[model samples]
Target: MKFLQIAAIAAALSALTFGCQKKAEKKASYPPTPATLVKAEGKSVRKYIDTLGTISSLHSVNIVPQVSGQIVKINFEQGQFVKEGDVLAEIDPRPYAAAVMQAEGNLRQAEAQLKIDALDVERNRKLAKDNYVDKQTFDSLLAKVEVDKGVVETCKAALETARINLDWCKIKSPISGKVGLYNINSGNVVAAGTSVITTIEQLDRLYVDFVVPSQRLYDVKRFMEANGGKAAVDVSYIEDDLGHRKTVAEVDIILNKIRYESGTAVLRGRLDNKDGLFWPNQPVKVRVNLEEIKGAVLIPNMCIQIGPKEPFVYIAAPYKDGVYVISQRDVGEGQLFDGGMRAVSGVKDGEMVVKSVSSLRLQAGPFVYAATPEGLIMGADSKPILDPAKMREFMSNATAIADELRAKFAKEAAEAAAKKQAPVEALKAAEKAAAGE
Candidate 1:
C-alpha cells in the first residue's frame, strides 16, 4: 500500500514538472520584406502600339529631259525650288527650229499638190460629161485628188510633231517642288529620255507612313468601327530627343491594307513641311491611340510578376489587427507605365498592391515595413537604376522566417513524433481536416 501511494505522488509530480516547464520562447519578429508597396494612384494612361517606319513623299517625280541636245544654258539655279511650268534648262534649239521650218515647208508643198489635183479632178469631171477628154483619164484624176488629200494630212501630223519637239528643248518643271542638284551641267550634251536632270518632290502635304504589326489589324479595325469614324484615331508621331521620345506632331488618317506575311499594316497622316520640321525618307515612330478606354484599372508593374508562360501579381490582405496575408493571382495587363503595368483585370483600380517588393516574406501579416517613397527617375544626377544587394537583403529576411516556424512548434513536433505519425502527413491531414471541420 505504501509503495502504490508513493508511485501516485511521483506521477503527479512528473505531470506538474512537465506542465510547468517553459514552452519554447516565441521567435523574435523581423520586419517583413516588402512585395513593393503600391498606392491607388489614378492617372491618364494612353494605350499605344509603336513601330519604326520610313517617310515618303505624297507626290514625287524625277525630272528628265524629253528632248536631246547640247545644254546651252542651265536655266534654273542648282537646288532651287521651282513652280510648275517653270523652265529649268535651255538646250540648243537651233536644229529643232530648223526641223520645224522644214515641216512647215513640206506641209505647204503637200497643200499645193492637193490644189492641183483638185483642179484636175474638177476640170476632168466637166470635160468627161461633155466627152472633151477620155473617161479613164478623168477617173485617174479623181483618184489622184483623194491621194493628195491624204498626203496633206500626213504632212500636217509631221508638222505637229516637229513643233512639239521644238518646245521640249526647254526643260520645264512638271510639278511645283524643290529640285535636286543638276545631273547634267551646262555644255554637256544629253539624249532625249536618257538624262536625269534631278528630282522634284512636293513637300507641302506629305505622306507620313508608319508600319504596325499585322496582328493589330483586327484590333485597329474593330476600334475604328466602334469609334464610328477614321478621325476617331489619333496618331502621335515622335522621334528621339536626348535619348528619350517626345511627340512632335499628332494627326488622324486611315490605315492602309494589312500585310499578310508579316501581319503588319501601314498608316498615313498628312503633315505640313513648311517649317521643314520633317524630311522625306527619314525614319519615324508612330503611336495610334484609339480614344480613351471607358473603364480600365491600372496596377503597378512591379505587382505584376512575369513568369515563363503567364504573368501574375501578389495581393495583400490585412486581417485581424495587423496580420497581413498575401495571395497570388494572374492578371491581364496592357500598356506599361514608366514603372507600372496597366492592369485590365484581377485587381480593382483603387485597390492597394505590392509595389516596392520587399514584403513578399511573412505572407501572414503584422510585419509590414512602411514603404519608403520613390520619385521619378532623374537624369545624370540620378541614383543607380538598380540595387540587387538591397533586394537580396529582403529576400534573406523572407527566407529567415522558416526558423521561427520551427521554434514555435518544438513541443508539438515532439508530441507528434511520440505518437508515431509522419510530420508531413500530419501537416497535410491536419490542414485538410482542419479546413473541413
Candidate 2:
C-alpha cells in the first residue's frame, strides 16, 4: 500500500510540471503590446548639425612698450575694463624729461647762433654794398647764415622728438577694451624692443572665427543671396545657461576657400557687444543660416531614429482592412532645419511618421499589435506609443554597449603593445650578445 501511494504522488507531480510548462509557452508566444498606436506621418524633418565655436572681440589690441624705461607705475589694474583713450601703464619720465631739457638748451644755443650769423650777414652785405668790403667776404657771411639756419632747424627737430618721447612715457591706451593680466609689475624694467606688458581687447565689436564643414556652405550662400549677399549673414550671441540670444550689428563675413589642412573653410561673424560681454578668443556657438530647403516636408525631431548606417522612420499605411499598419522606411536626410533633421527624400507632405523610435525598436517584436487612431484594436497594438522614460533607458543601454565595445578595443590594443614590447626586448638581448656580453 505504501508503494502504491508513492507511484500516485510521482504521477501527480509530473502532471503539474507539464501544465506549468504549457502555460509559460503560451505566455512567451504572445507578449503584451502597447495600447495606443502612434503612426508615422510622412513629412520632412530637419537635421541640425551641431558643432563647437568660439567667441571673439571685434577690436582686440595688444599693449606693447615702445620706449624703454623702468615701469614706474601701473596705470590700470589687471582685468580692468577700459575704453579707447584710457591710460594702461606708465614709464619713468625722468630720463625722457632730461633729454627734452637738453634738446631745449641745444635749440636755444642754435637760435643764439642764428641771430649772430644773421647780424654778421647783414653787416657784411651792407659793407659790400657801400663798396668797403669784397664780394667774397659778403658771400662767406651769407653762407654762415644759411648754415646757422640749418642748425636751428635740426635742433628744433630734436626738441620735437624729445617731447614726443616724453609724452609716450604716459603709456596711454591704444584702444578701449578689457585689459589682460599684467605681465610687468611696478619698477619692472621695460625695454624698447620686445615684451608685451599687457593686452587690451575691445569688446564693443567682436569677430568669431569658426569652421564650416563645406557641406552646408552652399545652403548658406544661397540663403544669403536670396535676401542680400553681405546683408543676410546674421550674427547672434547666446549667453550661457539658456540665456536669450541677441543679434549684434553688421559683423559677418565668410571665408572664400576651405583650409587644406583641416578640410574646413573658416567663416567669421562680427557682433556689436556694447554690454562688454564677448572678449577676444572666448569661444561660443554660432549658427549661420545659409538657405531654406523650400517646401521640404518637415516633421518633429523625435519622430526619426538615428542608427549607425542612416536615419529612418516608421509610417502608417493602409492594409487590407481599411486600417493603418506600421511601415518602416529609410529617409534621405539634409541639413538641420530649426534644430530638427531635414528630410530631403523618402517622405511627402501630410504623411505621419512615428516619433520616439527608440521604444518602438524594442517594444515591437517581429510584428507589433497596432491600435488605429480610429480606436479600433486590429489584432494587437503593433504601433508604438512612446514611453519617454523607458525609451531613455533603452538609449542608455545602447550607449553603454558602445562604451563596452570601445573598452574591448582598447584592451586588445594594450595587449598587442605588450606583445610588441617583448620582441624589442629580445632584439636588445641579441644586440648585447653581438657586443660580447
lDDT of each: 0.63, 0.62
* Local accuracy of candidate 2 as per-residue lDDT tens digits, 105-184: 99999999999989888777778999899888888888988999999999999999999999888787878778989888
Regions of model 1 farther than 4 Å from truth: 1-27, 31-36, 40-47, 224-238, 242-272, 307-309, 317-326, 337-341, 359-369, 373-437
By summed lDDT, the worst window of 10 consecutive residues in model 1 runs over 376-385
**Candidate 1, residue 158: CA error in Å?**
1.1
Model 1: lDDT to the true structure: 0.63
Candidate 2's C-alpha runs over 4 A off are: 1-50, 222-227, 231-251, 300-314, 318-322, 326-331, 338-340, 354-437
Best by TM-score: 1
Instruction: Tell me the TM-score of each prediction against the true structure.
Output: 0.70, 0.65
Clash counts for all predictions: 18, 42
Error of 2 at 40 (Å): 7.3
Global Cα lDDT for candidate 2? 0.62
